[model samples]
Target: MTAPTQERYRILALDDQRETVLSLQRALRPRGFDTEPYTDAARALDALASQPDSYDAALFDVVLPDVSGIDVLRRAKRIAPDLPVVMLTGDERAKTAVQALHAGAFGYLTKSTDDVDSIAHTLAQAARQRLLQRRAAQLERSLERVYGFEHMIGQSAAMRRVFDAVTKVAESDFGVLVRGESGTGKELVARAIHERSARASGPFVALNCAALPEALVDSELFGHERGAFTGAVGAREGAFERANGGTLFLDEIGDIPPAVQLRLLRVLQEREVVRVGGGAPRPVDVRVIAATHVDLERAVSDGRFRQDLYYRLNVVHIDLPPLRDRLDDVPLLVAHFVAKHADRSGHSPPTFSPAAIEALCSYDWPGNVRELENVVQRLLALVPGDEIRPEHLPSRVVGASSGRLRAVVVPEPQPVVDDLAWTDGMPFAEARRLVQERFERAYVTRLLDQVDGNIAEAARRAGMDRSNFRRVMIRAGVTADKPRRA
Candidate 1:
């Protein structure tokens, strides 16, 4: 098989030895590189200052005849702050290596230990790292602007509906709740609304409620005094206070414990928050946007979630469609990801063959758009070619039946045995008691897991008394690891 055409990279190589510089040029040529060799550090600095962007990276000897390589590295950085510079040394002194790193060298390598191939690898890594940093900075700035139809890339009807809804939703300050499966970009929709809303100039804070422990949820949502709880060395502002006069995005809203939910409801109604420790109620002007994957309507009916809180947060609901339901947008999304990943990796975007695109569209992306982006990034970094073929795709995506969108995942109902089923001999009261017991066990167990085995919080959220909730927890075989707070 013929070798893959490697990406051509230009470099400025400086060394005191002319023969060492000459040998480097010949060694790197086969690796798809062209070097501008310089034995003098002054001349090398002049070249870099004259045309900074001309070189993809810089290679300098740590100890030069006239000046130190660290000086040249510093100069290169100032000229093109994005340029990656690697330092090389003949001596095995750790101090020199540390100094070079402290001076902002992309990488440091000892000449006797690292081979040509290793050096080449480090240079490539540096280039990619710098490119990724630049991409992140650009994206950060882009997010601060108003988002509209082009906020996310797609031409499918489902995506069009989402964009249109976002435009209308941004016109008002109504509380928004974005509903979608994991990886469906719920946070992206929240950000789009925040950027376009009147509070664009204000802070847009986001927190994943599911990621925090139940014990800390209170402190995170509401500020705490210096002596509020354990490890409270200093007073800290909570998400609500930090997001005052702005927007606060609460992700995984369904996971919030019942006690916190009650407090959250109060905050929404009163437009003020009382710190965890004794304190005066401070008014806040935060517009909340929540996101969730669970079927909240069912949760409300099950009494695991508060009904009044649901109505307040669900003022304007936006449901994002899974990627499989909008397969027509696969090719467009694939192209966008390719360009994005390639730019971040410092490589030209490779084209995806029709067969490859077909395979991608055929696979059911259970993880949604986020999964697709990850796969594309992997292929971009590993696939060595100008075009991505069906053979280049993962085995799972190839030959897979892109059937209908996978069913929304939910907890399965418990099996009902003959004894559990109602009979003519059983009285209505007995039958009702038996069925209610089963439900209490199942709901209590699930809620315990949701709250990270916090029985007290689960009971409070379910609006059940503590001892009563403990009795149900015992029947459900779920144990609470946390002691009840007085």
Candidate 2:
């Protein structure tokens, strides 16, 4: 299929024999295919042009009622250049087979079910290939950019361990649990696993469990039927269903309530899910990769996390070393981030002076790679020269290099209203936003610490709904000191 809408692969079949069309549909449906057959070649061609993205591949009989299958193949290629079209015929003629292949037909198949089954085996792979080719062409035309590192850049011993674990885990279908501080790129690791797994051709669906409200976590994971809730206007597929034949990434897995955790465990156990409001249990073939910033071991002992669910999700555990623990990768990450943010804004990226890079490596990046990227972007925006020096670095970075500690995110030494430290050449609006964000992070973090990591109680103290407060916490990357028990 050139473009897969979701889970099912659609095929366009053109066969004058109505029964052959019907047989193809019935035969392929069980193998996760949807066949749209047209007896009239003209109508089939019309449909192909009208809805180009609906079909992943095409099947055409060598002889049509009104047109030669070879002619139809040529026209179909003109309509969708990347579509994989298979030719069908009982002809044993070598010339026709060669002609069809030279004409861009994906393969020549007999009308027998055996041939159909043979093509069926590679249908998914062809669809994925065609889709990727189309996407790469689009990117070349638009961005003039080729992908690099695939969202991960680390070469230290600790990170090498993570990469080793990822390579090993990607070879199987077992569930994985990635443990890391926020911004350490747990999602990146999850994505790498999906892209490297056998399910790479399928979807990669991710849901941030901490970002949603407690009232909606269940619905988001399991989906809901129309009229299931106040805002529910139509039936929907949950993460599990959406990720069928793929991998599902559940970030902040430790934040899910115990009840939802049990339901999740049930879904993993049964290999199917029943939507929240109403739906029959739909089978899903999804490999789950869960992640958490909090310490699940302590949570399990404290009764905040379910021990059984923990064991199930933790079939393999990968711990990402924090940024401070891997200073050797700083120069590499800094260079990459410089190019990345510079490319985004069409600026000629500058180089970091040795002292500047050293200062960056010395800082304890509490927010990890994400925080480093932010600092790098800020420097690019504020510093005007071709070279970034130590003075251009954040005071916290310089201070940390010289054995002084300050606030982690902002330039300010402390979270105080009266004291404000501004980055050189920062615009007033940019400065205001940085200050406000710092305040929000500090407020939520302090609030959580004061409440001993009790999120519900902290939300109450903030005078905000648990939903809104949780969103703030997520935006700030502040998890509870302790995971909340049910």
Candidate 3:
């Protein structure tokens, strides 16, 4: 393994006396300090002003030809107030030393004192103090990036609740259950929680329960002994073992087989795991965070999932609203994804035309945030121009507007026209009713198709709310599995 790099201290020495500055540099060099010696006080002040906090400390001579070292000390303090400045004087007058100390000097040293060891000790202490301050500032910036609300973009009330739940659970070690559609960013929320928790310094392990094979699911979660199975050539560790002292995020948890579910429950209940074909149970300290697009409660009620496991994992439930329910966040999500991909591909960031953004906002995203990200990446890769226009979007979006218009202008069949009484000056109410029914059918069908026929999400896009949307679906005779929404 490679050794870690040791931290180095940066020090600047300003004085008109070349001998004193050289001596200070030599003394600091032995202690692993990166030292810069300058005889001109004016030049040193200019450098400090250009990059405040550039050096951990500065040793200044009391006398200089052009500018007094005390003036340089005052100016350096103005640039970086916390920077340590030790004043050196040839005269040992108590009054001069007292004045230098009162003028914000970290220490006052007489050149004739010849105490190299004492000066080096004082500078080391100052360097440590400065290092602590820098570390504190860095930690604050990291915290802001991890927990800032801006990281999650959504203004809808449902999304607001999700934001609140994330904040509340971030401080706890209890298992979290994130339920949402496939594209709704459940993993992002899981990562955010792990980053904000006390275990941020530890590893974060993730596995997709639905993606793994049934036979391998158990060994994949709980490690196995050497020669446990044909493929188990050597002792191996699983996600739970790898995530010890940190967090293990189980994605699509509802799909885990019944046998795996029982084992998972044992781990959660006993805080220990027994590897496959292993003799004894090994204790594990891991925070559990599980997510699934399916409704675990409903699954349990229907006998498709274990009720005890559902309750164990559902200590903190965070339901992510689908993309359609939070249409207002499209522009923000689009901007973020564009910048992200642009950085990765080393391409200039692209701009979105108003019509393009409008098209995105108006259309229902069945796949949720994941679909939006894919669409954004696709537009960036395919659209050649600097600006993305409505025409640049995928065919599904461009066709939506035109198809709705055509459906309204032209009746589909003869029976439909006769029912509407196409004779000129037909009853106003009759025409209006016909138009309303046709528009609802077309609009609902289109939205359902956009989401790939997720009725719960289709209703959200239709703005009828989930339950009301289901009622309307019954009225319009729509089914879930038809791929009309996909």
Q: Relative to the true structure, how large is the alpha-carbon lDDT of every model?
A: 0.79, 0.80, 0.75
Across 1-486, the per-residue lDDT of candidate 2 in tens digits comes to 122336577889899999988888888787778889889999999999999877888989998767899999999999998798988888879999999999998788765666665767656655555554554444333221212234677666787788788888999999999999999999999999999999999999999999999999989899999999998999988899899999999999999999999999999999999999876898989999999999999999999999999999999999999998987677667756765566343244566754566577678899999999999889878888788898988787788887432112211135445565533477989778867766887888678768776778999999999999977865563434343355
State in Å the error of residue 320, model 2. Answer: 0.4
Q: Pick the winner on lDDT between candidates 1 and 3.
A: 1
* Global lDDT of model 1: 0.79
In angstroms, the error of model 2 at 236 is 1.0
Candidate 3 residue lDDT tens string, 1-486? 111126567788887778877877886676667779999877787888887778988888888887767777888888889898888778788987887888899898877545776677667666666665565454344333432353565555676788788888999999999989998988888988898899899999999999999988988999899999998998888889999999999999999988889999999999998899876888899999999988788889998888999989999889899988877567656755665565333244567765566567667788888888999888877777678888888877766544221111111123434354443485888677756655555566677668765767777666778878766644443333323222
Off by over 4 Å in 2: 1-149, 403-486
| lDDT per residue (tens digit) for residues 1-486 in model 1 | 111245567889999999988888888777766788999888888898899877888889988877878887887788888888999888788898888888889889988533888787877776556555555554433322212143576666788799989889988998999999999889889888988899999999999999999999999999899999999998889999999999999999999999999999999999999988869999999999999999999999999999999999999999999998987677666756765566565565577764566677778899999999999999988888688887988888885834322211112144333355433467889767756765665676578667765757888999999898877655443333432344
Evaluated at residue 286, the lDDT of candidate 1 is 96
Question: Which stretches of candidate 1 lie above 4 Å from their native place?
Answer: 1-52, 64-68, 71-81, 98-151, 343-351, 380-387, 391-395, 402-486
User: Model 3 scores what on Cα lDDT?
Assistant: 0.75
Quote the positional error of residue 377 for candidate 1 in Å: 3.7
Task: Supply candidate 1's per-residue lDDT for 290.
Answer: 97
lDDT winner among the candidates? 2
